[model samples]
Target chain A: MPFGNLTYLVGLIVALLIYSAVGTVFRTLYLLLLSLGFLGYISPESLVILLLVSSLSYACYSGMRGQTNRSLWFFLGVAINLTGLFFFREFSIRESWSISSYSVEYALIAVGISFYSLQNLGVLIKEKLQPSAMTIPFTDFMLFSAFFPKIISGPLLRHENFLPQLSPDRNIDWVPGIQRILFGIVKKTVIADRLAYLVNHNFETVDPTGWNNLIVAHLFALQLYFDFSGYTDIALGSARLFGFKLTENFNFPLRATSITEFWRRWHISLTSWLRDFVYTPVAFGLRGSVLGILLAILITFALSGIWHGLALTFIIYACTHAAYLMGEFLLRDFRMKIKVVVGKSVFNLLGWFLTVNLVSISFLFFRSTSCIDALDRIGHVFSCSNFFPSNWKSGFIYKIAVGGDQQNIFNLSITLALTFTVLLAEKYVYRRLESNKIRVGLMVLFMVSIGLFGVFTDLDKFIYGQF
Target chain B: MDNLTQIEAVIRKVFKDDSLIIDAQTSADDIDGWDSLTHLQIITEIEKHFSVKFTLSELLDVNTVGDIDRIIQQKFA
Candidate 1:
């Protein structure tokens, strides 16, 4: 079940209560059962697959515990988990192979298989690398891999970072937990869903003009950020209640001055994971050669693209970023010299402008249905007829006028005000509210605002869950 | 020049900062242009200057100047 559902909230509360009453000795088993039940609620078939994958991973690790060919075991573990991920995600391939319909049906319902398999593979790799340091019990590994909050979409927990926090002696922290969940709800319902209306409308437009397409791209970027990061907040908050501290996923990514800095700040866990697992290894193998470095980046990002999906658009999106990063790498000396020529503030402003626009432009591919659609939209962005604002007044006013029923202008005004309120809250108010009473008040206020202004009809699913 | 001085010169030249003074505790955060890109450049320059190669793990594990110094010492010893 999606975290946004009322039933899921009820389930969460009931689970927490039961967890609080359970003894420390049974805590691991309790959490493991809770995670399994959570997955079962989504799909019994998925739950079985998860259990199988987890069991296979645990057995592989156990077999490799004292083995001399630990690396071989690690490769085997990775291959098994990756095969599971590939089978579930690529239904077309299964169909082509004439796989049994029952297995295909099972694959279709496998929701968190991608995320959990990666988590399991990470554990196996770590164990192989430092066997002595990663001696956790099988139950601990199960709990770590299948932890409900992070199993679906993740702050991609490393075993080293997550396992130590699973000790039975930890106490639940309620204040920050509730605060984060409430904040996530507000961000999702108020900001992301509200922006989704405009984004969906404009992106679906067959012949969007220059400013219109640009505005749509920017809104899509914002919508994506709020949607994914909002889910992350809920996940982190839920995990916190269970006394687990998942890694923070986003750190105000929109404010980054460069794409490189943006990666460091955005989807931080995945970026670091790819860096550690893919980029570093490739770069290391190609050390002391610029061509090797470039190839490593290309391979890493292509894999990142493939990880998202097998779509051509995702590949373009990843390639666009790789190009930008490589360009930055090649132009480091020039950038430094430019920084020396210009003042730091001006340099930063220039960097921010270029970085944000480049990122927004690249995301056109990510948001588009296909490469052809994205290219057509990009072409429209530069067409001579669309460059002027002559047609913008009527179009813009109509879009914000709520179906063009009345030109009262109140809807547009309210949208701008609400957008600013969400931005201000994210930037300032949310961080400054420290006292428990004040946090509770803000939570109530946020709930009331969401009730009043949230786009409840045709609610868009969290964007990153697909990946 | 010794390893430290030679490494310092390589860092300064790569970063285009002549006034750089790096000690054991110095890290990427202490310098303006010491990002991952420049980091590779610095490593490459060091390897070329010292005629020593670093493994991928060693490159990843080196976080601070002190780590670099130690690795270089071990390589040359």
Candidate 2:
């Protein structure tokens, strides 16, 4: 067997055995073996990095357990690991040198390192923060970080809430947990994967010369949302299956009435993290003064941009959002006054329009590679004014969507109907339906649509997965 | 009508709502401006007014201006 396959199978067998046995010592030993086995399979440098990270994670764990200064050893370990990885990936691997930049093979996988690092560091920080709140033992904390379902792409676990649950107090309700996993399976396999086909096709070959690119962008936007949200659903559900309840990552974000609300709904855990740890602190730091507020917004968004990547496109995207948010803040009181004067419907429509367009514009940033790439795409959408995509003309579905080599009434009808149904279901219909029968019905329908029309296939990981 | 006057003043100033008036029994429902985000602002402001810092649990447990006043009195007394 290949080394990767052999290690993977062994890790799973050991974990399953330990998991079935269910003891602190057994689980910890299994995980340690798993980590070592994982390291054994990878490159020597990565193995070294893994050892360093494991040491850091363990230090953070021990620090939280002991209620000390979070093990400077742990902090040093994590900082060195991250900084070193960053240097290796950014400078050396990209350029091709050892000291002078050459890591030729170029496949530097830091997969799950960030998740583990953040979860552990968050544990250390939260321990330093609350001291008495409660800390899970080193074994539980390590396992929580390494939990197979979320280790790779996470609902980005944080330890503050995760720790207390790890103790014996948690009551694992297997029925609902299993049900959640079922929902996730449906979402990932049915809807997300289905949508992935069209979305991937559109983005991979979006031509800037005509109106086809515009249609492609719109398709990509919806595709990206489903792809990311679908992965989150699966992760959350999978966590539930294992008796650990992970947080929801999406809450009908596309149905949000405003940009602020949209953010609160989309990738909810990450947004919450940004708000609580990043946005709030920065915003609060700038507390009383307008300049302080400006500085806070700038810093928060810049950090968000950096979190996405070191790309100019990401930076511009963040800046565009910052500009809109500032404008929204400045105009908040004025808009309220407008609502009083222009009537509720007008005000709401305006707010929703601003939100949708703002999101659409920023998503373009998320999609594009560089500022120029983004700008060229935007130019094509707004200025090209002609030439529909020819590929979409092939299938009846494609014809119905973008056109017979152009836009179609059927596609618009379907999109509008689906969009309307989702909005009503999220907003009103779900609230009215209190019966299990109805919910099951809805789920069945959701599954059917996802299975039939959803996108999936060679999906890149979730947008937040990179962070 | 007691130190409710002082506490309400702090609440109004913190929420930037000069028109807000509340009695001992008044809840956040009766006080329109008092939402969770602003509620924290109110607690922090109340803490500043009384020169006291609220622990996270204490802040989490509070629901009203009177609760704020009582916590303050208990702490400072």
Candidate 3:
């Protein structure tokens, strides 16, 4: 069940209580079983794949401990993980290439393989670096790979960061964990789902126009941010209940003033993974030249795009970001000169505007049916007639936009209001509200708001869960 | 100059901040503009000054100034 479901919430509470009573000796095994149960509930087939992949990684890691040919083990482990990832991710294209049909039935069952494969591969690299120092016990490693909270979507836990925090002796901090869960529920149900209602409606029904597409694209960006980040918050809070800490996935990315800064903030763990594994190796191979860095950016982002899913729109989405970062790099000196001319504040404001628009426009490719559709929509955005606000009112603006049915108008208003309010609150209210009493009060308010405003009619699955 | 001192000098020149002070523990986090791009420039400058080249693995292994110093010392040996 998804985190937003009532059944899942009840199950979580019961799990927390049971977990608190369990002693340290059996805690790891207990949680591992629970994680398996969660996976079994989601997809029994995926649980088997997870167990197989985890076993292979563990076997490879064990083989490396005393071996002179550790690189052999490392490469073997990496190859296995990548092959699993590739088969699962690119299964549909196999027919075109005439690959064997023997495993075709199992293709769609690898739910969390993409994320766990990265974790397993990272462990190999760490083990290769410090042969004796990084050995994890089998049980701990299994739990780390299949931990229920982050298994569906991830903050992409690293072995170095997560292994230390996995001990069974730690105590759960109940209040903050529950608070985080409630806050995440508020973000997902109350804000993101509501916004998705408006965004999905417009994208599906409304004819593609420059004005409408632009607005929907921006809304989709918000919808995506809230959906994914909300899922992360729940994952983090769930991990916290189990006395484990997950890496943070976002850090107020919308406030980023540059594309590089944006990557550092948005989906921080994934970008860092790409940086460490893909970009660093490639750039280093090219002797750390300017050209090398550019090429590394290209290769890393292209892989990143493919990681999200192998599609033309996703590729374009990835390339758009790659281009943004490269532009920032090449224009750094020019931007600095401009920053000196205009004061820092004005320069930052302009940067924020440009970054938000550029990111939102790229989401068009991300959300589109195909790259060509996105291009057509973008083309419409620049057309002379489409650019005129007066022309939009003829039918596009009034009927489908501001003057739509009462429900549509209400959703549009609430979406905009919640988006801006949350943004402003993050900037002003939440940062300064440090009092315990006030925090508790706000938590209650969030719960109440979720009950009243949360869209439960057609529950939406967490968007990142698919990836 | 000592290797640390030489490394410090190269950092100061590449970052264009003469007043910046560094120690063995100094890292990218300690400097204002010592980002990934500037890091490449610093490494390039150090390679030029010391007449040495670092492989991809070696560069990946260097996280702090002390790490770089140790690598250089090992290379010299």
Candidate 4:
């Protein structure tokens, strides 16, 4: 179920109450059952797949315990998970194999299988690498793999990081949890949802005019960040309520000054995962040869693209980033020399502007329905025939005015003002606001603003949940 | 030269810094032009110079010059 749903809120409250009231012995079992129930509620088919993957992982871990052909067990575990992912995600392959319609439908509904399977795969690899590091019971392993908060769209928890927190002695910190949840709710319901309207409308246009496409491209980029990061905040907040600390996925990625820095900040868990599991291994296997390292980076990013979906657009998006990174690598010394010559502040601002625009342009591929559509939208950005901002000003103003509704204008103004205020505060005031009173006051202001002016319509699905 | 001295010479040559000094804790962050690209070049040069082929896991596991020193020692001891 979506985190925004009332049923999920009620369920979380009830579960937390029961969790706190219960003794230490039954806590794991109680949370495990609740997690399984949540999974089953989302899709019975997914629960079945989750159970199968978890069993396969545990069996692999057991087989590797003695270090006899641990590599074989690791490969076997990975093979099974990949086979499941293939069947679930690559439906066209199923069609070629003439798989039954009912089976295809079942595979399609298994939403969280990709994320949870990867979590289990990481566990298997970690076990193979350092057998003595993890010796958790099977039940705790299951809970780690199937935790409800992170199962849907993950910050991709590591077994080592998350396993120790499974203890009943872990203390629940409600203050940060409440603050994060409130921030997540406002970010999603207020900022992302409002921006989604503009993104959808402009992207759906058959022939977007110049400047319109550019505006929409940037809007979609912002919309995606707020949508995905908003989901992450909610997931992290929800997990924190139960004393589990999931990793942060975003770190002001939009403000990054370079593509390398951008990747370091954006979707941090996934990139780090690719770095450790994919790129490092491949690059190392080739003995760190120059060509090998470059190829490893390309291959890792391509796989990351495939992980997003089977779409050509996603592949293009990933390939573009890989190319950007490669370019950055080749020109690092030159850029550093220029930075020294130009002075740091001016160089940083220039780099930030270029990086943001480059990232924004590449996201067109990510947001578009197909490669052709993305190309067309990108091509439209330079067409001078429709570059009349004056002509489009009234319509643009009207759209933001939400069809000239006075209430919507008020709502939009509040959202814009609050968004700028939050950004400025984060930039200027956050570190200085050391006192609890100031922090609490800010939280209260956020809560009151969200209650008063947050957009409640459409309540669209999160962008990253598809992957 | 010892293993560390040989490794330091290889790193200095690959990164084109003649006056570079490296110790156990030295990493990419410590040297100019020591990015992923140059790192591969240094690794390739090390393998050729020492005639020791490191496994993928070994390559990945090494985070510092100290780790490399130990691996080289173990391989050549």
Q: What is candidate 2's CA lDDT for residue A367?
A: 71
Against the native complex, each candidate's DockQ, computed on alpha carbons, is: 0.45, 0.20, 0.38, 0.39
Return the clash pairs for model 1, or none: none
DockQ score for candidate 2: 0.20
User: Which should have the higher DockQ, number 2 or number 3?
Assistant: 3
Q: Which CAPRI category fits model 3?
A: acceptable
Worst 10 residues of 1 chain A by lDDT: A96-105
Per-residue accuracy of model 1 over A12-106 as CA lDDT, tens digit each: 88888998999988988999999988888777888888888888988888778965777777788888899878877754233321001112222
Task: Give the whole-model CA lDDT for all candidates, comma-separated.
Answer: 0.76, 0.56, 0.78, 0.75
State in Å the error of residue A409, model 4. 6.4
Query: Please, what are the lDDT tens digits per residue for candidate 2 over residues A1-467?
Result: 11112243344445555555676535445544565554445445555655566566666556546635556644664575457446544433322211111122345655556556556555554554455544455556556656655655567777655655454434434445434444444444444444444445455544645565555555556656655665665555444433566766777777655665676677676666665555655555445455656666667778667655556777888888777766666565676578779898887788777676568757777776556766777776667444555454453345324444333544455554654455455434324332223356656665686566443333323444444
Please write out the lDDT profile of model 2 over residues B1-77, one tens digit for every residue. Answer: 45678888888786556777777777766763343234445666666777787765455346666777787778878
lDDT (Cα, tens digit) per residue for candidate 3, span A1-467:
45557878888889888988889888888899999898888889889889988899899988888657788888889988888788766663423210011122234647788899999988888677645555699988998899999888887889888878767578786665666777777778888888776666666543445777677778888888988888887888788777776898988899988777788789989898888788877776775478988888899999999988777788889999999988988887788789879989999999999998889999888877667778877777767675545565545545444456767667666667877887667544334332223366677778787877888753437777667
The runs of at least 3 residues in candidate 1 whose Cα sits more than 4 Å from the true structure, single-residue gaps closed, are A92-109, A400-402, A406-409, A429-438, A457-460, B1-6, B73-77
Which residue pairs overlap in candidate 4's backbone? none
| iRMSD for each candidate structure, in the order shown | 2.2, 4.5, 2.5, 2.9
User: Model 2, stretches more than 4 Å misplaced?
Assistant: A1-51, A60-106, A133-135, A168-175, A204-215, A380-456, A459-467, B1-77
After superposing candidate 4, which stretches have Cα over 4 Å from the reference? A92-107, A206-208, A287-289, A383-392, A395-415, A427-438, A458-460, B1-52, B64-66, B69-77
Q: What is the lDDT of residue A28 in candidate 2?
A: 47
Q: 2 or 4, which is superior by lDDT?
A: 4
